[model samples]
Target: MPAPHSRSASTSVLASGSQVQPIQTPNVPLDRSLLLMSLAEEFFDAAHSIAPSVTLSRTGENVEVYEKLISTGLACLDTALSHVRLAPRVEANIRLRYAGVLYEETENFMEAEIALSKGIALCDRNHYYDLKYAMQLLLAQFMFKKSPKASLKALDSYISNAEAYQHISWVYALRFERAAHSLESSSLTDYHAALQNLRSIAKLAGEQNDRPIYMMASLMEAMAHLKSTGPESMEHAQRAIAAVWAYQLDSDNRIPQLLGLAHILDVACSLRQGNPTVMINKLKLMQTMMDEALRDPTWSTTSNVIAIPINRAQNSSQVVSPDTRTVLGIGNDGRDNLMLSFVSKKDAFSITYLLCGMVFLHRNSTSDQKGFKYLETGLNSLEADMRAPRASSGVLPDCIATLQWRGQIMCYLNCYMAFCAAAITDWATAKGHIEKVETTARDFDVPLVGPLGSVLVYLTGVYYQGIGDLDTALEIFQGKTFELPAETGKTNMMNSADQVERDIALLAALNSLWILQDGDRKNPSRNTTLIARLEPLCKSHPNKDIETAFNLVMATVETHPAAALFQVKNCLRAALNGAQTTANTQFLCITLSVMCNRFFSNVVGAQAEKSAQAASVQAQKSGNILWRSVADGMLAQCYEVNGKAADAKFTRDHAFKLAQMALPDI
Candidate 1:
């Protein structure tokens, strides 16, 4: 017999010749079992030579090692299985080794499954029960990607047969993983199962005084509640925050990840409560925590568009923690998790930038441009990262995963841009963004009108309305809304059912207002139905600005000119004060136009006229041609009321010129 050939590192070292003993060749032929074991050892040694651990790869050089390992492993396993016969023990070990190598080194799930299934069968038939549970666990986990229900069944079988062998953490981790997967579907049964799993973990953690587990479980439970729109979601979020505060000690980083999550949940709950001020504060805190996490030099740099471990808190929190046990290592796991290559620091940064930008856009309209700039930078970084060659997708193709995220981000960014453009009467810009989003939705196979669909549609209608295409706008506003799909990619302001409802209410109200202005006073019944729908939506939500707009529309529908004048005056005062203001130029123009109508009808006082004049000056300074036209028209009406006929004619002609310039080209 001769020694097996070694293709890797050389065993010959001349400098240490005295200490090194001569290798001896056996005279007998090697047994099948020994040869199989030797092959497995050689495969692992070759793999380890390039990578410290099979799971971690910090450099491109390690990727080359993985490719080499896969090729060698496949060849060796194929030769051994084809030509050799071995004892049950050796056979089971070889199959398991082959399965692990295939799973880690390549995307060939079929081969891996065949090897794992064979290994599992060997363990079962020979009563080699020690490896059975581990093999089942791996198989079940893999099945989670293909079929969650099948994975759940396997998990149940494994638990039933090997309860004593499973670790406590493993038990909880599996349950959490199942619950997380169940959320992908819209079935109530799945939601109930997820809730039950979280509740069980929460109860056990509470009983054992395990604050960390309790914190994570409670947060997840809060998210589950949010998915179902449960009444107790906010309370659960508060409880999670309390748990963190209770166990947290001031140290290095001070549990930044936990604190960041708590703050994010707080922002979500606050938004649901319609508390913009509170949401803004929470967003600021979350930004601070994320900045601290990114500043830590220990975190590994990633090549992919790393989603901040903080997703919109739903859709996918897997990026937050690799597994349940790793949740405890939040800030610490950033680098190690990035090495896994599923997420990157840029993903996290983009999300934080987006949230902060949202606060600026909503809370302070004056800073809306700043918000757009922030979102633009985030989106650009995301696109660049996604197109990078080194990016990895865990189970799906990297390009497909990148497209999904790109579609998701563009959906929100374009929607927000539409709102900003519509506010300033930039109809062309607004329409362009909406069209891009519509195309993106179609290309990505996402719904154009799901949870956020109504808002997108509403914005489209508003753009038409701004251009004086009232009939087109009305048709769109009154279009039928389809039922939403069970799974939309992600949940946020741009894609939530609540946002859709709110937008629908506003759209309907605006449509009715347009009908009344079009001199369709003969159709009071239709107008009444629209007003009736708008009243409830406006009253239910505590957004003062929206309520103000609703009030103005309601007064117009009721033909109460004085009341309309009062609302317009209030809007002007707020816009001037810049506190709780509806400072949008287009809306200001509408209010001023309403005031001009009231003045011509002898329905307003001297103070109302003065306020209207002030609003006109502000609108003229806004740089939107449509609003400038509306403002000039209001001034022309004021001149006519004051009996200045010559001045009125000159101003009316100027208003007409501005209106013509503002109109969109057919």
Candidate 2:
């Protein structure tokens, strides 16, 4: 058979007297067609540039303008190709551009798929190898949201094709995509495999002098390492930071978006290290970086929105309800519309606000209000983004569009809100927020075994504890168990999700121990049994809060009065130090109340009075009615010990009223 048709091949006819005549095809004027195509490209670029802004605004007027702009571009392409023959390569390029605009700007995905397939067919017929591969990659991206398994299969075939063709860059890109898919898998094994692949890619890219790919791989490696536990994780984080710093120093290689992401990683690293002071300082610096990025016009236009890749595993049997769709901002088409993995400047700002709120809430009573306000501001921004109207649910929104990320962030916001409200004795509001989280978890199909679910479980226990249902709270706390993996003579690093799950379990156990000690003051053996189980776990986990709580429990169960007093004083000193270090007023108040009770029972009137007064003040600052009641009750007993009968009666009545207010049934 003759060679397949080539765009550059010419057809000629032999004529009489050995003369040859060339066959000509009808075509547009080269210059005019070139000018039209160039204009079309400009229109496409402009449309893309303003897409984020349009998503942010979501006004009908803005949407209309965006639609018109893309339509004009498509019209120009049609005019250029009207009744004219163009080279296959040129035609394929134009078709691909048309497909992209359809996919991105118009959100006409079906039409875009048709256009792309046509372009790919043209490339295949003309043996345009490079363009064919590029179109295939684009096709994979398009298929990903609709059918991830199909997309992955297509990507795997492309990776093999790239290798067969010895296309090094394409191979790296394809492998990167594969690794990214693995990273999104729920399996820990897949996650680790992805990390290893990313590290290899970074090393290879650096050796090949592909700076962009190198930077991307390095940054991703750093982010993965940041989610991990142990000293080696910290070392990896530091190395990644240094690498990014080096890249930043090369003015020619500076990327504002990558730099901003690096800054976030740096702050997160501090948080992972549990250094409040360092994390706070880094947060301030990050805020400055974010502000600077917003102020730069070029950055605002070009890099305002960054895509973070994610692929959520969906259950085919469960169809999301209409109400669930609305709550999740999903489109009416029943497609996973919110699966687009994009984060905008507004999203970054809101995330920073969240981090600030979390820090302040943990820091001390003085900053609790500031923390709550920050959380409110962030939550409002996110909610507004979700409420914005979009032309189609299938179209990617301009906000923090990733479903998993958005859902997780909202859960965290609600969880923290519940905690803050409960601290202030707003039981109704606290329960309302908790219920919202449960609703979100159900709507999003968040697995109970996941990090978000673990948090919800722990907080539910806290809610029961706050309401004075000690039995129920104790059961909830004791129901969950976390066991360390058996040592294999190698360091076993836990990822952030696993770490969170384990921490929540530890915290629940600590709560259980507290309940056991409080409820069975005469049964020291029961407390001893629970403490025995907790010590090994706490030693392995090594959390400051766990350690302090364990110490307090052990002190409470001491049988000898003198030894009990000495242990209580030591525990108080430790708690005071922790409160100062972390600025955690709630912990301080709890410890002081316990100390006040100890002193009151010992008939140390003056010491009990001082501890009770201090505990009450701290409780007031924290807005914790439960702890305040405890303080007042202890002070009443101290008054009785000092023979102040009237003072004792009044204080006791006030304490009883506060208890009733905090726990209506009791």
Which residues of candidate 2, in runs, are more than 4 Å off? 1-129, 132-172, 185-215, 247-254, 298-342, 364-368, 391-405, 440-449, 478-493, 517-526, 540-542, 557-577, 605-610, 639-657
Estimate, for each residue in 281-362, the C-alpha lDDT of model 1 and write its tens digit: 7877777777877886434444442212211122123222332222211334432111112334566576666666666566
- TM-score (C-alpha) between model 2 and the true structure: 0.67
In model 2, the clashing pairs are 363-583
Q: Candidate 2: lDDT over CA atoms?
A: 0.65
Q: Give the worst 10-residue stretch by lDDT in candidate 2.
A: 1-10
What TM-scores do the predictions have?
Answer: 0.67, 0.67
Q: Model 2 over residues 1-666: C-alpha lDDT tens digits?
A: 011111011111112112311232355333556656866765555554555555555567666655655677788787765644777867877776676656565556687788778888898898766566656766777887677778778887988876666555555656677677766665567667677777766776666565545666777788777666665787787797777677666664455666777788887777666566887798888888888878755344313333221111143112222221211123333332212133556667677777777767666444347777878888888788667643322332433245446666777888888877777777788888889888866654445567777777778888888877888887788774434334322334566777778778777876766666574434566656656666666643434656666666666664322344565688677766666656567777887777767655647557767767787778777677777788888778888888889998998999888888888877
Error of 2 at 50 (Å): 17
